[model samples]
Target: MPAVGFSPYTLYSREEWARLREDTPLTLTEADIENLSGVTERVSTDEVVDVYLPLSRLLNLYVEASQGLHGITEEFLRKGNGKIPFVIGLAGSVAAGKSTSARVLQALLARWPSHPNVALVPTDGFLFPNAVLEDRGLMTRKGFPESYDLPTLLNFLGDVKSGKARVEAPVYSHVVYDVLQGQTLAVEHPDIVIVEGLNVLQPAILPKDGETIPFVSDFFDFSIYIDAAEALVERWYVERFLRLRQTAFRDPAAYFHRYASLSEVEAREVALSLWRTINLINLHENILPTRQRADLILRKGAGHAVESVALRKL
Candidate 1:
């Protein structure tokens, strides 16, 4: 276990980590991963390296550990140890860089010696289409747990973790904000499958009838929650909104094209309002509460630096 900081719940100072875990043994070049995930222009966040890099290595270790355990336990049903998928769950609030962190980890974990078949499956794929949400009167709660196809998501994870001969997950298009039925992501039996989304750790929302159901996180050998203060996350949302207003929203075919040309003041207002109305509510009621269920927590500082990490004690 890593030494604790002044606080009992936190450990890993920036200076101490930088010295102990320099970015070495990374097969992926910086040029390929220079820009952090979800960051279009550029980012100056300190957590990009010091925190995420070590976290990536830690995940790799977890993958290896799971493999060891699996081999010993499944003596009868065993096959040759060529490669097995390592599914990781990445969860966080809006503007917390959960998507970015997910992409970064996918790349990092793939480059690791253990798993070259690393693949990413964002829960965005399971989000109900915009029209469907509108039909259900849930357009306002787009990212909320209720807006997703929980059954499909759970089944998808089951197949991924089951070592199925072939598994396909529906692909969701952002422009349309719907799952393209019959369109699927083909997995050639990945060595690692990283599932990223807002409520990946949420328990299965089952019917009242007495029946057992496997929650998505139940299959996750290791899960991470990217955490940040409310204020910081709000600021990031505003900044990202403004940036998108200038770029993606400008695309005529973009789903958010209506947001283009929003003035700085108007954009900030919209961002704040959305955060207060939708994102914040989801975070408080569904997302944030699941943080305790995570195996690791990446707590960010004001400047988006991962100032501390909390790992559940074995």
Candidate 2:
């Protein structure tokens, strides 16, 4: 580690990071990118070649090293425990394009023969049901730390790390804006598991009794935080809302269907209002503070394109 005043990360410009790709092949096509992108976002092949390919290479190396270490530990203990999956925690603000990043990575990482069974699990599934939030009077605080089922999330991670044959994570529906009952995403023994969410990197509160507390990030073999200027993220959120108003929000079954009939100006105001009252508050109070805790940070600029990468020095 560097001295206290020195930065822990080695900052890389877009060009500088692209050079790290070396001879890594581009396995994704334009159609594949279109399928991996978010509703209001599009990930170009250049972005995949320049940004994600190198990341996939780095993660492949890390997974190989981790698997070797796990094997060594098992041999030393004279126990033949099964292979442990590399758990990656991905965090970012809403509309920051972290979902696209997660999907892209899942596709790219799965292409690597060493870890073909990569799993992508979003933490939105761990959020308390809408009814539970309404009863707790936390409907407006939807993305806040308190709005999640922390114990369930923690147990799920623990089971995954323990090499369980299969672990089920609750399924959340963006259409209904709630956790779906009797629905669960079954994660079979994957070689790598990418867990994405808004507050995945948030630290646990310490108890006065000095008890051990395992945070969601504690199980991560590596972690990434998608970052951008507050104003930029807000703009993306509003843009996404406007697009959704014309699309998903028009569906009668969509949870935000009421917003579909609003005038453009009215929709913009509502989007800004939600940002100010809830999303912005969560970003400031919880999300932004956890950025430095990530092993890697992808900073986005205009058009939701990643402008820079900061990787913590090993």
Candidate 3:
């Protein structure tokens, strides 16, 4: 561990954190990792062993504790074992590799015998449809908090935490860049639910009537924020954009199909412009502000490799 500091987090080097994975069995193969990783994001089995195995163990400890606490509280209230899902929130910038983290964690946590049923929910599904955003004139601010249907998202999560069964959420399509009409994702009873988004940790907005509304983070049993330098994130975003141009953007059905025909220089210029005008603004104004609210922070270095870990002090 690094020397104790004045910060509320205890920092550990990658070497020190990897040791915490002692005796934790590795079940994922290279193919599994490749399938789970996002475009332009590199995640090796070695990275999983060093970074995520310890994270899984830590999450298991928290889940067990939360289950026990829920039992005691329910007994005190004269209720039955309703089995509420343990919720985890993951927040990060656009190219900070949060999707890969959520998928990897879902895969690893499901392998634990104690919690075989895990569900992953990307909050993109909660975003308002493009049509709705256009009506509100928020198309340019798509990833901002205002673009989401906060009431519906809050209700869905509240239902999950209340042990409600068969709760459904709208499904968003990246291919078309809109919420799918008449399509929904059912989140049945599960041992754990991982909610990943850029604004998962954002603070709640006060309504005009001054009635207090619950923030999404209020339901989280644990939260994680993936961090990297802004310059590195910008570079990653540009690289990912270039990769998608040759792959997904080549599909006529893709929302960004127009980018497929651009030359490499033109593609890079477009990506940089988008980063400067939209993504960077969102990162600075919303995402990075909530970093301290996370229970754990994974600091990434070049090549998307996690260089250090900071676990919040109890």
For all candidates in order, the CA lDDT equals 0.78, 0.94, 0.94
State the TM-score for model 2. 0.98
Predicted structure 3: lDDT? 0.94
Model 1, residue pairs in steric clash? 86-192
Error of 3 at 71 (Å): 1.6
TM-score of 3: 0.96
Displacement of residue 105 (Cα, Å) in model 3 is 0.2
lDDT by residue (tens digit), candidate 1, 44-137: 4345467666777777778889888788767756766444567888999988988777777777777777677888888888888778899999
Better of 1 and 2 by lDDT: 2
| lDDT of candidate 2 over 122-152, digit per residue (tens) | 9999999999999999999998999999999
Off by over 4 Å in 1: 1-10, 16-24, 40-48, 76-84, 205-210
Ranking by TM-score: 2, 3, 1
Tens digit of per-residue lDDT, candidate 3, span 192-279: 9999999999998689998889999999999999999999999999999999999989999999999999999999999999999999
